[model samples]
Target: MPYKPIESYGVIGDMHSVALVGMDGSIDWCCLPHFDSPSIFAAILDDEKGGHFQIVATHEASFKQMYLPDTNVLLTRFLGAEGVGEVCDFMPIHRDKHGNRNGIHQIVRIVRAVRGSIHFRLSCRPAMDFARREHEVVLLPEGAVFDSEGQDVILLSPVPLKEDGKGGVTAEFVVEAGSCVTFALRHADDWTARNDLLSMAIDGEEARSRTVQFWRDWLSKSKYEGRWREMVNRSALVLKLLTFEPTGAIVAAPTTSLPEEIGGVRNWDYRYVWIRDAAFTLYAFLRLGFTEEATQFMEWLRARVSEHDGPSGPLQLMYGIDGRHELPEIDLSHLDGYRGSHPVRVGNLARTQLQLDIYGELIDAVYIYDRHAKRISYDFWCDLRRMVYWVIDNWEREDEGVWEVRNGRRQFVYSKVQCWVALDRALRIADSRSFPIDRPRVIAARDKIYETIMALGYDKERQTFVQVFGENALDASNLIMPLMRFIAADDPRMLGTLDETLKQLVSDSLVYRYELEKGSGLGDGLTGKEGTFSICTFWLVEALARAGRHRQARFIFEKMLTYANHLGLYSEQIGHSGEALGNFPQAFTHLGLVSAAFYLNRVVGKE
Candidate 1:
């Protein structure tokens, strides 16, 4: 009916794609066949024109949603005054011994009555090619086939179904306390015969058990036994779900064009992988003993490092989930945005930006993963070495920083700090493993970079680092100096920077990304105002913890935890009214959560 809050949806995926099932029992958003495929249901972006598949009680009821413990299987319950109904939603996880996805996907929903009599309505709407292509509906004896040209979406069930006047299928039935109903929404393939699809609905119970076991087995490999285990485990699950298993490249988030500022023009697609986000996710996985993902992305990274050669460097800021380089931006002006946020968009244009900070994030990940999981071959080492040389040649260049601002490039201090990190970690790896490197040149360059930053980057009068080496506006990114090991946490200069960040960029215990105040015309390219940055808040917490302000760090950490949705999921930012303002279940926010939690737990326990 109306729009659901971004945080009101729970995610279930087969590691190839995910569907956002709302608390009201509607699959409001999903991309079938692949993570980047056209949506079959997109009501999250457009309420009326965008199609949806929903299973709900006909009677009014209060709803509650949760994940099955330690798994991504979601359960949504409708509790009415007279009866209660439950829907168990999951995508069957089918992976072979070698971990291949086998190129087929399905969303199997098993519904049951948990209490007295319940009346349920089930509707499966197909909006092919983002609701642009029309589909021909062929009704089966107990199911229906929606064919948008030759591509078919087969929906099968035990109950009888009929086509509504609109281009969709609908069914209504009543179930007693012990009865059950099943629905399977599948991506049609030549191999999946219609009878086999029917049998899938018949055996939904076995499939549910297998899916649950798959998640549990994957989660069993985690090595974290620290405080806040529930929230930490949920973050781990979010990371796992966001990962596109076929390529091992995790998408930043599933749904796209959900605005950073509602009704503002800040919306951009996040259903693609960014080098910085994946690198942080790798660190989170390695911290919890998930070495397989670490190993998989290393193979994925091998392809990315050699794919492109732009003017600035070899790598772009982000890539498609399947590792495609060309992501041409386009606007989908047909569908209204979520809550009428205008001009819904599909592909991201930011991928073309020259964000030099990615080198430090990616190289740092490889360095850590090599030490923990497996040894890097000389070929992989060479790729990393190429990245280091490029950074050395280009560290003095001004370009887009980690935030990917739209204004013209400036000498962002954070970008320079990461350039230093790239060289520092590369030197450490070379020395540790006897890898051949230009040791003299590397050392000279690293030292010079350090000297230059301390001189130009730091403001002597204010005793703090500036946003762009010349401007005076405080940035939460500069707090990353200690986290990146560029400066000692308690260094005199860093102490002043930390204090200034708190004073300028923080409100109500949450951290803003940067100042909108005009120091160097920072807000020139930005759209309307934005909310507090979710990841930056965690960065502040980690920075404070490292600086030995343990009490304030813990207070801020606990307060930020309260902002997560009921299912322990976080969007990219929090609005002024505390609503989720950006894409839901953001990878960057969860990675920051794990990083801060891992460091905070260890440091706090020692005290």
Candidate 2:
């Protein structure tokens, strides 16, 4: 089989983990148990060694794929000259009467002939531990099981199957119109547990109905009834899918090591939860009236803060879905990387880096949640107060900014501005709740940050705030100044910064994080160039709209939407040639889309 383009896939998940299903009816990327679990089928990263489960049509067929309306149930239609068949794929959301998702981890596929008789071929190949560990296959009455050292995968189907002679299963079947077959891939700790669950025959139609209702009911809670409702709703759905329901910690993306530059070494694992991303996601959920999600995340954040060891600061930059702090980076030397982008990495090392800006984002999210969702508990406020004091004491220090630049830390202007945001929002929360916060000290610290950034972070000659102090280079992150209320959007300084960013960092409305020209002395501790950052581009749209450039913001926002994949999904970045370049279905990109749409709609009176 040939490799599919990164964008040629749609995602389905159970809010615990996700699977990337290709249009060709193949599940190329799926982390079995959790979002960060080792891949059982990873042909998306390495087509040759990585395993896959495919149910493609035997005859030559054209494919059309879509999600069932207002739901994540994916339907991929295989149209052949003689017959038309469709495969509906979804992870059943088993919820109780209270609308909480029970821990049901399984992928269900219903194959049916829509037209005449159609022949289909099914292949079930399991490569446990990223194909690094070998497994044994056991034939079962219902289907087959792939048994590994610590885990077992059961593939159950009504169709007959034969051993593929390569420790896998293959089946061929024909179905006439009105006939259908259901297939399920389930993970278990042991065979007995798997058989116990499989004993209860899963009704395909009932499961489909339940899944559809779950999504529709959840989406009904959305408060957004504005222009671009479909796009905004879809982005919200993607964000919800990326969330790890058990902990309320959302992964940046499901799959990791998808290169930002094709065959380039810029890839890093994004499966961990970055505090900045979680905060932004919480803000988005709050905006859409999903207060439940915000509350869950706030609880998670409080727990993480409580676990902090004082001197090391409030929280790590990122953490595992279960809130584990130690995520050591490792390279998978055995399997070839995506397009041979060398040294496939797992477990981001940036967790240990000092990213001071996360404090601002986290505090800002708490402020939004406190105002819109619910009141913060007094105990949680005490923990947050410690973090706020930490920020006040360390606001002058330089650390990694929002971009998490690997190069040595400098006095990043955005970081200082965010420190200001932290104190400013902290003051608001204190005032609103009548909490006895240190008013004078926090106010002085906040004002000092603003003054320092204006004096040292700005380049008077270039008429723009540079990426760091004493550097003339521009960065798209500085555009957040107005969005954060650090400066008025139309203020002469901010306008100059915006104009300089538009001239240097933007290419045809797509925004780059920074200028990456060689010998420019601004490399981010990595070789090769990268794509236009999707989140930064959307940030530009919001910045422009805030600056009263509504028409221009709408134009750029509409253009950026066109860059989303056929299924309205976006990755971390978009290449110069307009291809999605990093992890697929990135939460940050979709969050940016929702934020941009919210602001643009309001400015254009579509709210």
Candidate 3:
């Protein structure tokens, strides 16, 4: 099979891990057990070697995919010359009494003929450990089991299977209208064909009904009744799926090594949780009235921060879902990257880099959470206080900004502005919540940050803020200054900077992070070009709407919506030709969409 476009897939998850189901009824990319677990099928990255499970029809047909209304259950329809058939795909989500997702890790597929008689072919191929490890299959009367070194995966179905030319199993079946088949792929437990397969398959329909209810019940917490309710709700659903429920750590995306540029060396693993991205997601959750998630993440953040060594700050930039901090970057060179993008990478090295902006993002999230969700415990306040002091002491330091550029640290303008934001929010929290803070010391440090940014970060000649303290290069991240409340949106300086960004960094409603071409001399210490950053484009929409340019913001917002995939999903970036160029169902981009839609819709509704 050929590689499908990144956007040609819909995602289904149980808040632990996700699977990318292609339009052709194939499970092309999935990391079982957990989002960061080794891939069970990575055929999207290397179609020849990586394994996939497919249940496609035998007859020639066109395919259409959609989610069941208000739920993550995906339904793919086969418009065939012989008969009409549909496949329902979902990962069953079982909730505890407290409404938390605590269930088995599995994928359930239901194949049914919607019209006349239809013929179907089922293929099950398992490639453990990102397809680098070999496995043996044990055929059974109930189903088949793919046994790896120690981990085993079982595919339980009602049909008979046989080994194929490749080390996989295949089956064929024909069914008339009103008939169906069920398949469940899950991690092996004590249950076997004699004990559980029959009952599990029998419970497939009940499980599907339960999973759909779980999602709908969760989505009922949304308070948004906006002009683009569907889009906002979809983004909310994507954010919820990316959330790691066990610890409340939200992943940036499920799959990794999906390049920012096709065949370019920009691919990096995003399965881990970054503090800044999670903070952004927190804001979205709070806005949509998902306070339970916000409260859970705050607890996660407090516990994670307590584990950090108290030298420079209270937390690292990112961490594993289970709170592991030592994320060493590794290159998986054997498996061909998506579209042969070389040197597929697994851990993130940027965690070790000094990203001072995280303090601002983290504290800002705390402030919002404290205001909108619930009061923070004194213990949580103590953890945040240490981080505030750290910012006061180190806000003048040069470090990676929000973009996490590879270029050697300079006095990035965005970083300094965020430092100002950290102190400003701290002051607000102290006043509002009666928390004890070093009033005089923090105020002095906050004033110094603001003064330094205005003097050195601004370029008087260009009438705009520059990327670095002493340079005039424009960056899309500075578009966030007003949104952070560090500057007024309609201020003359901010307006000038906004114009400079549109002229220098934006094209056709898509915004690039920074100039990638060397002639611009804004080198990020990386080679090759990249797509327009989708998160920043939404940031622009929010910024423009807040600036009172309602018409311009609405137009840009509408145009960007066209770039979404058929399922209303977005990746990290958009390629030059409008293809999704980075990891699919990106949480950062989805949260941006929610934020933009909320702010834009609010202001427009008032008019």
Candidate 4:
């Protein structure tokens, strides 16, 4: 079988859920209600038996897909020798007065004939519970229905759909110029309720038009009328698509287990929100005039920080949509993994680890919130102050680093710098509001941490920062030193670190998190190679721009943007072959794109 590279997928979503549409016009991964939910269509893992929703031209054709100008509406065109046809895919937003988000998600694929004629093939094979249960199939005049184990997939198609066996349905029909074909699948607990196809069609179309307007209106408010506007806007749209509108929870990525390495065991589930990326996301959202998202995230952060009682232990690394804590890791041994990367796993096991840097992330987010949102309750300030005190007491302790390495714990330089950041931001907040903190102690901790990291993490021989004390390997996490203002952007040490990282960690101008050979050190106890870290690359671009290497920064930035699929979407890592790996349409990656684009746009001229 022919395998399209993983980067061939395009993403479509309403705030509540998302689907990955491939170049072959198949939705191989989709989770209903939320990004973390069980998949309704998961053929991306098991190509043959796992379910998928596909709409393709019956005739042999070459395919191309792009989003409508400045909108999330995807237009996929199939061009064959005899004719041409297009499939316009979008998930219409349910909105209300004042633009408050509503909870309904609708995927509309409007098939239009652009030339003489084209035959269309429509099939929806939905495998629930990972294709384990047998489904009761029913055929209707309007379409086919499959009821399996309390989950129902009702297909509304204009053409007659026949059961192709094994809980699948297929339809082949012809359309001429000016003709249209529409299909929709609605998920409900009950399969007996009659579906109104005419209303669904009308509602779907209306939703599409409204969604386009919503996106266009959102982009219109962007202050980013600079160089690379198209790329920046596309990245912004993808970020918006990944955001869960109702709760203001932004997922790390839409689809999970895309794998970081091919046939290598570096796969991870990235459907949950990470504190590691929260502060940066706040900055990106605020930069784009997206206050609602920032506000929602800040609220979520407050809840997370407040829930864990005292600060002696590690902060929660990530959480479920409503902030549930228990993420029991599991491996699905039944299905062969994506592209023969075996042992498909779900529920990240890293949630329970002690990553010290999250304290810095939490503090930074709160500081920004204080600046943007009004002064919150004094109780909130007190809670923040206590958290800072906890960091000061515990920063010296060894814990899992930012990468959440699975081997063993070491005093990671990045973790130390962020601990300093926690104290620094807390000091700023306390001083700004005149809240009393042990001024000397906070300053002492800050300076001591800074000096300690510089003394230990820096390698005089290499003239660049190392991953840990007494280690020679370079880490992309050090790229944030200049971006975070921990060091002067042009400091000789910073320059050397950047150069060293470029030479070691970067691949074709993209960045990886760190050398896998070093071992992550947290000990979930697995070993394998993964994709180049997406956020690390953006950090490199930002550090480069800050260092006054605008030309190199701009080139790398533009080149990195090309890694995005046609819809301007990115995964967690770029594989060795440039295929998107390790989760589809990662939020952290999209946020990095937005942030780097803003900086690059400011420095470079309109291109």
Best by lDDT: 2
Ranking by lDDT: 2, 3, 1, 4
lDDT of 1 by residue, 1-607 (tens): 8999988888889888899999989999988877788888999989887889999998899999999999999999999986999999999986679966545588889899999999999988878877888988888875888877645788877788888878998999898998888888888744355456645544678878988999999898988888877888999999999998877998888888888888888888888999999999999999999999988988898898866477558888898988887788788899899998876888888887888889888888988988998888998888789888888888899887888888888888888888888999999999889999998988898899899889888888878898887777777888888988999999999999888888888998899988877576685387788889999999999999998998889889999999999899999999988889888779999989988998898888444
| lDDT string, candidate 4, 373-454, tens digits | 6565677777777778888888888877887777777888999999998999888888888887888989999999999998
> 184 in model 1: Cα distance from truth in Å?
0.4
- Deviating ranges (above 4 Å) for candidate 1: 95-102, 189-202, 605-607
Per-model TM against the reference: 0.97, 0.98, 0.97, 0.94
The digit string of per-residue lDDT tens for model 2 on 73-132 reads 999999989799999999999878896765658899999999999999999898898888
Error of 1 at 423 (Å): 0.5
lDDT by candidate, in order shown: 0.87, 0.88, 0.88, 0.79
> Distance from true position, residue 552, model 4, in Å?
1.9
Q: Give the TM-score of candidate 1.
A: 0.97
Selected candidate, larger TM-score, 2 vs 3: 2
How many residue pairs clash in each candidate at the backbone level? 0, 0, 0, 10
